[model samples]
Target: MTSDLKNRLAQEAQDIGFDACRICRPWDVPLVPDRLEAFVAKKRHGQMGWMAERMNWRGNPAALWPDARSVIMLGESYTPEHDPMEVLKHPGRGGISVYAQNKDYHDLVKKRLKRLARWLIADSGGEVKVFVDTAPVPEKPLGEAAGLGWQGKHTNLVSREMGNWFFLGSVFTTIELPVDTAEVDHCGSCRSCLDACPTDAFPAPYQLDARRCISYLTIEHKGPIDEELRALMGNRIYGCDDCLAACPWNKFAVEARELRYAARDELKAPKLAELATLDDTAFRAFFSGSPIKRIGRDRFVRNVLYAIGNSDRAELRIVAQGLVDDADETVRDAARWAAGRLTE
Candidate 1:
């Protein structure tokens, strides 16, 4: 009876637009606490103090909700139709991560999770809690524990069916369901992801030092980025996708079902100079539904300045020079740095 319910749940999830769904017990990921502790101990999480603050809940999904018996891990594909790396060649443009190029995945994925959770409760008479990226739930680890995919060498989940270009969401329930077998590592002898990092963020295979990661630098970081790392950032003004795009498993990536995940024409190769002119109001309006809006104008322009500094295009110096006296100290700093680099 439980097997039939699980099978039906998977079909329901797929019908609701999730590419994959698998189940595991909330206590399945026993190794997370140790790994998370070690990462925080080394200060590798950088300014994401919340990772340390919510250590216990994040490390133990069972502790997150004691009543939860099974975790339904779901993968939603957002694979890009074009070469994500192609924009890097055009130094005049700012490269936005494929995931952030359109509607926020959090909003889209959470809605799907909620719909599935509601179905589970109706069919099985169990309470359910749904989570997207915002939660402390270790979705990747639980995804692996549930056989959705193995965590690749770059530390992101990679699937034989969907590749590494999918988002993860989870449904935790009080009703116990049969668990799927955990996936084993299939990244043996592959260092593609590690070598692909422009900032050398990976300290070793499977270990990421967020302090040097471009995605962390351009997004979560609040102040001016380090001088050395800024140069390596290239034209990437938002989150970086170097490592994910480098993975060989992406060849089998499933096509994204949601039209909103597709990159907008303007974002695909946005002119860095045009981006730097966005004031607060313009920034908000331009990125109203984009995940990039959360970073605000100052940080967004700061990243643009870093890209301007790296562009080696003399014409962009005027764009950088205009912001050197801006109100935000960090923006002023980035502007001065970009102008100075262009001058040299």
Candidate 2:
């Protein structure tokens, strides 16, 4: 009967647009606390101080919900139909990562997780709680424990069916559900992901140095971006996915079925020249439902300016030059750097 609940929940989750689902018993992710501690101790998280603030809860998932008997983890895929590398060819345009190109996933994942949790309570006669990325849950490790995927050398979860384009969510329940076998590593000896990085952010397999990661610099780092890493950022205005894109497992990946993840036309590949002109009002309107809004116009323009700096189009100098007198120092410095690159 317990096995039946797990299988039915998995099927229903797929029906509700989740790419995959698996259950695991309430247990500490024994290796994660040590790995996270080591990573933070080495100062790998960069300027994202929040990762340090929730140290205990993040390292130990069981402590977040002590009463929970099981965790039902789900994966929602956002794999694109085309090669992400194609965006690199258009230097004038900015590449936003596939996951961030549409509706903010937290809203979508939470809605689905709640539906699944609701059904579990109705069918199994028990209480349940749901979480997307918000909670201090070690989501990646929990996904691995639930048999959804295994954490690759890059330290992000990858799977046989969905590649690394999926979002993870969990439902914590008081009822004991049968746990699925953990997914095994399929990475073998391939190092395509490590070799593909423009900034060579990975110090070694299974380890990342955020100091060199473009994703961390643009999104996580608040102050000035490192000069060495800034130039290599190219026109990637948001998160970096060079590691995920180079994975061999992605060859078998499928496009997302959930409309929530469908790439937004405006976000798919925004032109840097056009983006530089967005005033605060325009920026707010442009990214109303997108995750990009969190960074605000100043930070968003800061990223856009970096992309403009790498752009070779002489015509774009006019746009970058206009921001030199901007109120924010972050934006002003970025504009100066961008305009200088063009003149030089």
Candidate 3:
């Protein structure tokens, strides 16, 4: 009966739009606690202090909810249709991460997870809890334990079938379902992801120092960025995809099934000058459903100013000049730096 229920659950997940689904025990990720402690001890998480706050719950899924006997890990692909790196060549424009170019995945993925969880409860009469990226849950490690994918050298889950461009969601249930075998590392000798990092965020294979990660810098960071890292940021205004895009396994990546995951034309390669002009109200409306909106106007513009500084385009100097005396000190600092770089 448990085996039959698990089979139906996987089929239900696929019908509901998940690209892949697998089951694992909540306590399967035994290495997470020590690895997480080491990462926090070294101060690698940067401004993401929430990562350190949860302690036991973040590292151990069983502790998070003692009733959860099984973790149903799901992967939803958001693979970009075009080369995500193409926007970098147009320095006058800003490069937003492929995932942020459309609707926010948290809302989309959570809704799907809820539906799947509801189906599981209806089928087998067990309580369930769902999580996207928002919680302290180690979704990637759980995904790896569930055979969704192995955590690649980039420290992100990579599936031989779906590649690295997928989002992870989990449904924790009280039902004792059959678990799949953990996926083994298939990366072999490939260092493409490590070498492609613009900020050298990886300290070693299967390790990431979020302090130097462009994604953390542009989104999670609030204050003025380090001058050296700012220059290396290039035109990337939101999140960086260098490592994800550099993976050779992307050759096998499947197309995103959801139409909402497709890039919006306006966000594809927005002009830095136009983006720099956005006030708080306009910024909110412009990025209404985008994950970029969570950073707020000041940080977003700060990232834009940094991109403008890296562009080496004299025409955008005035754009930065306009924001030099802005209300936010960080934005003002970014503007001054960008304006000075353009003058140089």
Candidate 4:
């Protein structure tokens, strides 16, 4: 009966546009706490203070809800129709991460997860809770534990079938669904992801220093970015996908099923000059349903200015000059930095 129910749940997930689904027991990742502690001890998480706060629940899923017997892991593919790295060559344009180029996955994935969890509750007569990157759940470890994929050297899940271009969602349940075997690390001897990093964010194989990571700087960071790292940022105004894009396993990746995830033309390669003109009101309207909206206009413009500094296009310097005395100190700092670089 458990096996039958699991099969039905998987089918329902695929029918609802999820690329893949697998199950695992909540206590599968025994080493999560130690690994998490080591990461925190090294100050590798950077400004993401929330990672340090949710110690018990983030490291141990079983502690989150003792009644939850199994975790249903789901994968949603958003493989880009074009090469994500191509924009870096065009310095005048800002390169937003492939994931943020479309509608926010948090909203899209959460809606699908809730529907799947609701179906499971009705079929197996048990309670369920769904999560889509919002909670402190160790999603990559849980994804590996559920036989979905192993965490690659870059610290993101990679699947032979799904590749690295996917988002993970979880459904914790009271029903004891049959669990799948965990995936073993298949990264073998590839360091393409490490070499691909523009900022060399990986201090060692299988580890990341979030402080040096461009994704962290543009999104999670609040104030001025270090001058040394600013030039390395290079046209990337949002999250970086270098490591994910460099994975060899992506050769086997399948296209995303959801049309909502397809890239919008305006966001694909926005001109840095145009983005610099986005005041708060315009920024809100432009990024209405996008994940980039969460960072707000000040932070977003701060990133655009950083890219403008790195672009080497003297013409764009005037655009940066306009914001030199902006109200937000962070934006003003970035504008000043850009002006200096362009003038030099």
- By lDDT, the best candidate is 1
lDDT of each: 0.95, 0.87, 0.95, 0.94
Q: Candidate 1: which pairs clash?
A: none
lDDT of 4 by residue, 1-344 (tens): 88888888889999998999999999999989999999998999998989999978999999988999999999999999988999998999999999999899999999999999888777778999899889889999999999999999999999999899999999999988889999999998899999999999998998999999999999999999999999999999999999999999999899998888899999889999999999999999999999999999999999999999999999999999999999999999999999999999
User: Residue 336, candidate 2: how far off, in angstroms?
Assistant: 0.6
- Model 3 misplacement above 4 A: none
lDDT of 2 by residue, 305-336 (tens): 99999998788898999999998899999999
Candidate achieving higher TM-score, 1 or 2? 1
Query: Lowest summed lDDT over 10 consecutive residues: which window, candidate 4?
Result: 117-126
The clash numbers for all candidates, in the given order, read 0, 0, 0, 0
Q: Candidate 2 overall Cα lDDT vs. reference?
A: 0.87
Give Cα distance to truth, residue 215, candidate 1, Å.
Answer: 0.6
Candidate 3: give the clashing pairs. none
Clash list (residue pairs), candidate 2 = none
Span of ten consecutive residues with least summed lDDT in model 1:
117-126
- Which TM-score value belongs to model 3? 0.99
TM-scores across all candidates? 0.99, 0.97, 0.99, 0.99
